[model samples]
Target: MSSQFLVTSRRDMEERGWDQLDFVYINGDAYVDHPSFAAAVIGRVLESRGYRVGIISQPDWHSAEPFKALGRPRLAALITAGNLDSMLNEKTAAKKFRSRDNYSPGGETGRRPERATIVYANRMREAYKDVPIIIGGIEASLRRFAHYDYWSNKVRHSILLDSKADILSYGMGERSVAEIADALAEGKTTAEMYDIRGICYVTSRAPLSDKAVMCPSYEEVRDDKKAFAEAFKIQYEEQDPYHGRTIIQPSENRFVVQTPPALPLTTEEMDAIYELPFQRRWHPMYDEAGGVPALQEVQFSLTSQRGCFGHCHFCAITSHQGRIIQHRSHESLLREAKRMTELPDFKGYIHDVGGPTANFRHEACGKQRISGACRNRHCIGSEVCPNLDTSHEDYRRLLREIRQVPGVKKVFVRSGLRYDYVLADHNKKFVEELCQYHVSGQLKVAPEHVVKHVTDLMGKADAQAFLKFKEWFDEANRKLGKKQYLVPYFMSSHPGCTLRDAVELAEFLRDMHMQPEQVQDFIPTPGSLSTAMYYTGMNPLTGEKVYVARRPEEKQMQRALMQYKNPANYDIVYKALCQAGRRDLIGFGPKCLIPPRRLKGTRPEQTPQRRGSLQLPKKTRRRDTRGRK
Candidate 1:
């Protein structure tokens, strides 16, 4: 099936004898097929204002044919947004690695899109140089600054200048997209729309015209790559909405795009986005052709909420969704669950259901609508703002309602739950409910690191908090008499982690008798605050000196500490100790697993003689002088 983007510069131009349109919205991948949803939302909002609009989803956006497919209309203005590309790239482990020798017939290689969202914007520039192209979504929003790319292993700057988009919107696109559509429809120039919240555009002339916008200097963020990488690594490993940090806005010109008031969608509006007749399989085309193996057949995913309250130093959710949580109604969630149960190959387990933070319900502490933009990105960081409310009463109701859904024999909170939020709540009922109903034998939570200093740097819960939560969880499980186990997630070699810190973690693990199977090395993703710290040894926001474990040896030691018993780790630990010149830890120091002599080698005198006769040892044993005298 061919997909096309619907765009026109003129209102009713197609109806008024125009043959084609001047603009087209391009997308990067097929999986994140939400351009259509955004388009539908924008179309509905515009129609409410008596403006004509059409929506389209161009899956293979690289192909120029889609631009022509949507019958051309007299041009007015081009508006592009939300999803520009699949943010998941080769560097993100989205693709399986295959060797050339292992290549087989009909096997696809290099499935990644050739052009990034910025590259697509550049292509659009080539096709329609004068047309307005707005870029948004994870790609454009995050990369609107100079940052490092793990795939190319190099530094990059604002995607707007690179992709050649006229303007870049930096957050959720519904409200912004609607405003842009209306403004353009009303004949407002692109320059007039500059002040819109969440939009980033380059000025035709500026004192710093060469730069896209006045953002934090690359030098400020350059040395912070390791820190940022570590932060991103923690986010991916935990997938816990509560455990992330505020990813810094790259540009001073870039203020966060705030989410509109939770437009409590009726069940019908919820159905519109979810009930769209589209392929839900992991790979729709591959499945139909029987190319997907049986192992790939069963896959599950769904979104329950749209925003988060717990913002860590390394997260972008607050910037994207705002601190206020927007939840899909319990009835809507139940309907989605029912739909999942009716799937042709439905298994009893629903893979996961969640949004930015799983347990977040749209309800706030009081009925008052919180106003004013958030100065800080995360609400639940070191200091909770007076305006912030961390209640979960409504979330509890949602979970209870979801559990009662028909045909859903079991539900799994596979994404993640904010253990800190659960622990902080006035009641322990949610924890009890989770233990008894939601968990599928294992409950995953991210206590990123055991070191307090490192956890503080990462804006995560300290050891004390994690320990308390663990104790509560254990007790809850025992009380329920359930077989569920808590799978605590951890990160290694984050910014602020030193060899000594790693050793401390090793000691902590040994004391707890916890053996971890997964240990993640920090990978710097583009456009994160921690990535800047990881690359540079200073905080991008504060410019304060921060510790970073960049050396391979230091990183190895940190990883080894997580897996002390693995023989591979023993080699890593020994090598790291030798590199650090801390020979004391090579053998069993308080933290070492290998004995000291085992690492330093035995003395000749310590070796046993083959025969009973004294073969003068390299160093003769001391004689009993008093007895001899």
Candidate 2:
């Protein structure tokens, strides 16, 4: 297994009979030689082009001593904060420390430092004073522009400025990373590598291109919230690859310049990248420590595409992967499927077969490839555009082909399906087949919320779209004679979401008889329109005033409403109902969120306790919520 993996120690390099390495990848997670991990993908991509690469995972930040273990790379030091932003990985949306880090071995926590990109880059500089350090992955990509840092409670400059790395590869970095490595290897300095797309660097001179856009500087955005919102608007609209311009902003004494994103990979390129020889599992060193938790679901999965067109405000996919989808050919995917069948550990089940959005197997429309995604409009927001390609025929064909492969027991589409996108398509075969074969017990979708304002602010489809899909799903399952369900993911305390809006969503859940086990509290990560709105209190795209739930208590109340049936949320649910002046919902009626407080002098037993706290429960407790009795 160690022979199959990239060089991690001096012994591995010696075993490979190499005295020098082209690039040494520093990652925040334990070294896992899988394409699902960014560190592995970049390393393999470099290897394919005849470059030697090594791995240095989760080095100690106490000093420069640990970074030198892998020795200095001849080309440069490639660094990433693993697959997720270091802060988001370490803390929950409530700013509380997370109990576990799935990306770490044995589901460990505290393995990586806060702001890992900056910390790792600084240490690399200490280890090799003149090494050309490059930072990428979610942390550097989303923070390419000055963004509102929710954890710090202030606006911070672009990560390129803070990390002090020679170059920052912003988006999916297959192209930019290779170009950077080639330039470095060709005796070119980092200062001469500004023309690469999807890369950002700091400079002192003004932008030379007439097409470049001058956004508000760090001082302006930091001092004025309105300035911050305006700057975000420019950043959001300019994500286009075909027509996008270079973005320049002043930071302190220097400036940060970002070129337009790299174009979506061609089918051949996508196929070649995914078909790389990957171990597809955590390093064997962790075999005794229960391996990496993150690989459990993905080891048997296949990534059939890249990019997303949903463009939800809270999501940064469009910012990082762009809005135009790029997919591998069916033949390429089938090849990967065939390989999985031969693995001894494969359970004959392909856990998933999708990307950012499961059903988006192609670009949004023909125009996107030519002129790029519309400047200020979303592909599917309140209404679907007439030019939008709402066909899932290709995706359906791909799934069917996989299912027909040898030794593949079942092919499940575990990733989320844009329900609105499903409804927009006239053909119902995909959804019907999905319900019949792909789904195990449920099909999960994300409507975000039911309130029109919240959905509008979030740039998501309305509740009508979700309900229609739910109806279609239930009918399809009933006709198929299967007892399946639809799990709709809803978030709370998003920008523009108020107490009344939460109440409306709770009532909608009650009407649907849905007791959602999880409710996502909106996290204002960098590089999202929602975070801009959260920081500025105004929608950057629309210029409308937005109500942000900045208080922790308010956000908790909003989250509790969606799970009002849970005994632990009774107090918060009551507080929210009262705050919204919706006392009508606090009664013995079946539609009520919770039973009215037990009579003032009621007996202790009559007051109810633990999970069965509601005295006048309309639904029987049974053995538990699942009726396991």
Candidate 3:
């Protein structure tokens, strides 16, 4: 088969001699035929299964004309809100319109409509009435159940009902989409797909499955915070594939049924998906608009794995990809590297070679493959589990093999690396290899915070583990005669973080001589555990009260504390110090975070230890001068 992009227009379809499409995949992002993009992955997956897939990227949702570009698909209309949630893509954390969208042509903003899945699905319905519509991707996946919308600042029903989509395929849809396509090929209706795994559907009178667990109804969660917390806890717990159960939630007169996640693809299965004929770049139609900027970061990258076992509360990987790690085979990855070298744009650099968590190539523990992750326990948290196989030998070897590829000069791991897990490994070879080869002068790791109390709430591992990793990282660079540094990522204003905690974190930064280029304030995006805590002021897992900086001023102070050295944050830092009873940090002392303003001076100045001690004791000064002479 030709390694060309799937049909995007009628001309392309006509060229391929296709009378009708097997699936018309609508996406909120620009057409990028790379594997990293979900639309590309699903379209290619269907094509690989002998289905003629047509892509409608970033359609004009204001009318149905754009949806008619590919005529009508024979089987289903697959829709997704791109790789990111459309609301997040179009707006900032402050709910202001973003100026640029990397997913669009030339990074233009507002190219796609907000609430893209619903808008696109509605448009598809208008263009091809009676066509079965299937919604998936991050937006539909995260909001598969009743979810809180940060932009709207209210709880909303499942996207299925809003989009009028026939079926909702959550998580990685390669497996689910294939099954759905095969079933549709066999002349099955959307109603029969209700029993499919990793899918969701709505019904007015149909009863939920016996094995399903029901969440707090939309009315209950919307009216009661405690009920929302309880509902989110159950949803979080039942995400594991091994022990997860179908979940159902009700809104008004209908019920939304979400089946358990699809089982992870085996290594061979994963390799086959990646090995599919992908153009590996955005469509040529985008060339005039400077191509897709999103492709720059991933055009040369090789995805070695999928899924993450490090279930951070702020991350949606657990809710989307699940905690099970599905890695590609070494042969598969090496072949990709070789193929990348053949591209005309190839310059002998492979940008990245990892997934959600870089070093995770295998399951967390042996038990996970059989019994699944423990319902209530973390794989590597305050302490690494005894069964946690923190080995990097395979990862190290894989890197070596890729480095040996004929035209590959460098391979970097830019994704999140669990330093705590790296610390657990006694074999220091991976750390040394990382410092010596993979690092691009700085390795970004999310310690998130230095304080144990704050990190615990963030689902980060022990604070001491980060310190240990820092020590080993420094030692490795010293032995290797390299000057690479660890750029630790920290989050401020997270739940359970107080002003005092922010001050403590600032002091830690001072001690480390690190001034972060950027600090993230906790964003309560929907569906994550952190958002649950932000909304309810309680940790859903434990039902314990959490200290959330809800006030705008308080949140600003916490964020300002992270960048305390910035001139713009001086006032907020000063106010925060005073509020925390940390006046000692406000003086002109060497360790002070901010200098004090002289009562009558035009600008702030250094102050003596005491009011009358400005002269520095003439006798002591003379004695010091005499010693110097």
Candidate 4:
């Protein structure tokens, strides 16, 4: 383990000649000093600015005593719910408790309490009422507004108010966090730090500026679906950092003010952030409990970029990281690769060099920085934006440089790719090189759904785009004499998807002779356009009604349709087909999805087999023998 790991104990602080620290970072995950972990990134960012920061990871939330492990900080304490929302980390799409947690030590669950930000905040307040609490990370960032909560089946107020934290920092919070720390150091109160962008706070009075947009209040939206939909539309459109307005929402006795998003860091600034001295490993104290499971994949991988322009409706990346794409320079990435090689357990492989969309290293257009992402339109829609830059030359160059790094034998680009953008690119060389060098036999692309209505609701290109990309991918691999395949990820039970739509997707898969092993069931997580639609049954943008699958059985049936080959899902698939009026598809013909029922006298074991086609014996024919009959 690297000795450069962050201090987790008071003894380590004393060894460094420090009796007290400036900021103590309370994290929901077990300590892992890797950049991919938000806890480590924020800690390192503060350390780079000459602040003494100690980390306390996954402390006991039962009492205030555990939160006081690091004692009182000279300044304030920063908190995060690790890399994912606590509810998301602990529960599955089906709302069942997950037995293993990737962010916890030894893949153990129950290490952190549910609604961890709220839980930790309460404990911290109990321990020291005067210490200002600044909460960020995925949980607090997405829930910063009054949004839908699928777990509880209702609308909830801003996490900032719910947790009663002094300030809530949203998005990739490097710049805003610095402003916060500086203000606290200057003896400024949280109330005085109102001008900082990318943060939300409670104020007794209204925002002084008339430019602020007052969305539906907590009371109005919680009770009225129309008000909720309108508020969500306003929130979705104003995500741009430049053109966005200061949004205020009234709560019971006060108001919550959210400033415009923070501007993205420049290339040089992005480089400096990633090049910070990080141990890139879980703390050795976790060595006994085996290491934090989340670090294993990212310890060797590099996050060359942050933020996504795709803005998929189901994803929280846009709300948490903001829209504009930010990336590191080639030189900085190469430096990180060299350091990875120096580790004792280092293999010759570099697992991934991608972010939300691996191939989208450049912004959609040059005007993004000058103005902002378009107000109500998607950068990608029915047609690729004419102004969109589809060139992959920069990405190609970056990959070439990393492959030449000494001791790095193989490099993989395992992150999700926007096939729509790739298909739009005129250059075939990037595609060819990717098939030959970067891929280890399979490349993952997300088409989400096949039906136009469903894909439109998902903010994805239509299925034809994926088909064309697959054609090009096959051609590229053929030219290189390689046998690479594409794994297309699909989802079920999103806002606009109904039983009919799921059956359409299942039939599409059947025609393609593909039965996917895993299917993604959409969970209406906070701060997403799809979640608003799920809760209100209306498209926030257009005010048109949308079909929502809120029942547990319906959602399960939709998921089962995608993996219809599984015998355990047979009953659900049959019920789904019958419900969708697709019983015509339930035969042993060439296009049949399943075999006919047991014929009233067949053996008990006569069930559909999980084979290439999942088809059982075809009914024998008295067929076409009309003349003989």
Candidate 5:
């Protein structure tokens, strides 16, 4: 079992009695030999195929010597910015530096250098000038094309180009990485593996592929927001593995060509990947600094599936994992549960038993595998597709089996659940089981917005679906004799959201009596449909104008409306209500969101005069989606 972990140092290599490694994996995360970490998965995959892989976890960026800790590999150096993009790890939407990094050991901050992938690649190049560098993971995957970087506030070139790497494996890289390793082992140069699907590489000359879709050049996207949006739309439509086209993005000196996404692993292949002998814990080297905080969430949690078809515009899962739901078999999950029971830290509780969406245990529909997901229509948004298979019998049965495991006491599903899909199910047994066994009091659901127009732009199901699910949840708890609650999540200042829209959302929240502890201020991360809307002020899908709240004050007002009950947000909420002509909501009425009185210890005369344009509120009563007045 000790030898199962890949070599990380000269001592480990000597222990393994190996002369040299085939690949040296450089990651900006602490070494946690678990599948949840990309370094572990890719390393284990390469090892399973008879390749010797070494790991360099969060090497010091100030010097090149840290990159050469394991010496040079026999073949290539594979790098990932851990499980998250490094810039996002270091900074927030307001561009403020964060104080802690969960992926780092001891939850410390600033362990990895900024722009981690590029930084790591450059450092490795400094160490070994001629070694091939292959970069991937969330950072490289999302930035494979010219992208709008929130931190830099400008379009940046592909990571492959910026990092000067030999190749960039965009999506799930198991198949492509294996093929690259094999090709390299067979005396092929990294540049010759450009034809491999799921990888992007830079070339000095234009690509000669006949089936390529040429995107707006980097200069064009940099100069024109509309051109950027158009290029994003093209990339978005071609993400399907079955029907995706080869995409080529041009630059002045070279071309960045991305092959179509790799085909999804079959159920058997997914089972094999999970069945790999992952120690399922952080490497012992991290034990002294209180271990890796990131593994705590996933240690007891079993990932029964991969990928999501929910297709939320703001989510990057659709772009990275694809819309197809590739799930593990019941036997594989049960074995994993048994394995968890044997672990010394097992607390008789399975923290979670789900993936991106909890209830999705199979493909969205019958034709998804054959025809690929519908690019034009969402499977479960706006309206549930007629072809949508909303049954949860398999998932329900799997949970039942896990509950019966000898050492397991309770199992919870803490991952995001698509409630609209629950509403579409006619069987209704899964909801009962979920409430009876899975939910830990409050079930978290993402109903991003209540306004139909806002939801339409966000590509989410209508609020009525959420309303129906809430009713079902309430009734289920009542029948089961349980005291459970629903914790609905909301997003503020999304594309197309206005001051009026925020006010409407506030009214809906007031009716529901939900004062969320946290509110997500929309951050435009690259490779998402919503980011395209944020950048262009137009729907990439429709090319129609959308009102985007760009001003910091306007964005603050919208976020304030979500938690209007908080005393800190009173001024912003008051001004927003007044500006949106909803002054009727300002008085001391029970329905009012804020009080008309001034703050404590302040004179009434101190209250500022109301602006003349503040229109009198209308008397019409609008029923919420829950049918509440």
Candidate 6:
């Protein structure tokens, strides 16, 4: 309530040692790690039950220093979230681009720690073998099964077993973290805590054999890395919950992990979660290197809601968060907004709010409450429950409230908004408001592909809907007397796209007179429905045959479609046309506007006699020029 935890000083921890610590929380990634905030919340929860607590932020879990720093105390347990290190490459030009103005005098330097949450857990295990290490967050939640790793380009098992954490909390952490802390403080042992929902833990006999007791097979998740990464990118771009079975296993050697039921938060609960104290500063390291750039300013972010009803095949939100829409209260959002406004040299705007699908206010229809997402693994042919509502009213209201907060001036919906939902609204007032107020002349919307077959395969909205939405968006901006432009996000080389599809898309771009600023190659992220199609060429849900373009040439064509303006793409486009047997498109296709080349003369025509005869042409030319002069 005080927001004092927003600024964690070393002295605060020094004053509160092992005796004051009811639980020691750990973070896998520094970006998501908010020791000060976690400590304050867990400590408050513990204190509510008459126990004291302290927090340790990104401590050297590998060394005994952290353990010694706290000394020997009534150590209740160790809590952790998904990230151990920032998954972003600190040395990347992307990072530099994101923080151009914030560039330090020395330029951006310093290596980010390994981002795998399990890495930090393993280090913690090394120091405190018997201590309970509870893991949660995106890294732990999504990886709680056999998953494909983009960084390593291989399938791996759940972080729980890999890191040897006592328990793995999946999905949203607020309730689960509190429950786990309360259970541990009551003297429940690690083995006894398995009964808690949204957690994954090993049985006592887990390590006795090489096999996992409850693991899914590794063959299930032996997906291709490229497909996995592409699907993952789509999920992030769409921000719609994907509705298909994820690869839960890779090989017989390792078992795949599945999550417990998704817990949808009510507005009240969402309010309480956001109200938790968050460290509202750019990460110290990031700041020291020069503050984060405007684009990368959201190095630390929090979502105000979860679950999406939009059943996009390329998204994992529905699978991970369910089709139910949950939200935090307006009061809670304002509180966080105020905290963000209070940062040192803080500007008025916060990065983003909302989750899964930003515009999703509730389930599609009117199902108030229901069981967690049906873990059916596929939604290809399944009927969408009528109760789910994909309306934008609630979000519109939330955004309106967020914008009016005292210190906040601009509230960007950096999260993906379901364009279908926005377009379906009978009135265009909301769209106009978004254009005039929230957007900064550039609004990002995902129209993953122009190919109808592929969009159907990926469970995305048809291209027509995107076009209609584009029209309405433009109209809305015009009505509001604004010059905002739509930056449509497109994906190339998805699971079921072919060279023809890519070519058609290229033609569409040419017709629209639009060129994309960024093009994302499909990378299959682990644990999503789309990944299965990318890997097996079959939809996991319906077992239906799906076309996948995997050849190097096909991939090149799809990629070239997004870069029509680049000269390098000329050869690529040519080869694509040739390979697709569209030789007519070689010189100047409908989409490609290059000029044709002249034909060459045969060798016989260039002999000495032919040359002498042709010499007359030169004499005629000279005579004509002399006469004219």
For all predicted structures, in order, the TM-scores are: 0.72, 0.94, 0.94, 0.94, 0.94, 0.76
Write model 6 residue lDDT over 85-179, tens digit each, in one string: 13322322112222311212223323224444666676666666667777765556666665655456466665767777777766655567777
lDDT value for candidate 2? Answer: 0.84
Provide the global lDDT of candidate 5 against the true structure.
0.84
lDDT of candidate 1 at residue 588, scale 0 to 100: 47
lDDT of 1 by residue, 1-629 (tens): 11322233234455555455433444333222221234333434444455444433333356654544454323332333323223333323213343311011123334334335655566555555566677766666666655576555566655765676666766555556666766776778777876555566655333333212232344444555554444334322222223322223333344222112223333455445554433344223334434422123124556676655565545555444555555566666677677767778777676666765676555334432344234434345444445546667777777667667787777777665777766656457777777888887766666778777787777776777767776776777789886666666666777888877777776676666566655566555555455667766777556578887876667767787766666546677766666656676556466665564343442323232222111111221111100000
Return model 1's CA RMSD, one decimal. 13.3
Candidate 4 residues 262-321, lDDT tens each?
A: 999998999998888888888899898998887877788988888777778877777777
Error of 2 at 597 (Å): 0.3
Q: In candidate 1, residue 625 scores what lDDT?
A: 6
Specify the poorest-scoring 10-residue window by lDDT in model 4.
620-629
lDDT of all the models against the reference? 0.53, 0.84, 0.83, 0.84, 0.84, 0.54
What is residue 262's positional error in candidate 4, in angstroms?
0.8
lDDT of 5 at 534: 87
Model 2, which residues run further than 4 Å from truth?
1-3, 598-629
Give per-residue lDDT, candidate 2, residue 322.
89
Candidate 2 lDDT, 287-364, residue by residue in tens: 888999989868999899878888788878878888888889999999999998988899899999998788888888
Candidate 3 C-alpha lDDT tens digits along 1-629: 25688899999988989889989999899999888998988888888889999998988777899898888889999999888888888876556787778889999988888899999999899998999999999889999888888889899988998999999999998988999999999999988877788999998864656678888998999999999999999899999888899888888989988888898899999999898888988899999999998899889998998888787878888888888899999999999899899999999888888888888999998888788888988887665678888988889999999989999988888777888888788757788899888987777677777778778888888657877887788888889997776666677888999989999988977666555545567777777888899999999999999999988888888878876776667888889999999999987787888778523324322331111101111111100000100
Stretches of candidate 3 off by over 4 Å are 206-210, 598-629
Winner on TM-score (2 vs 6)? 2
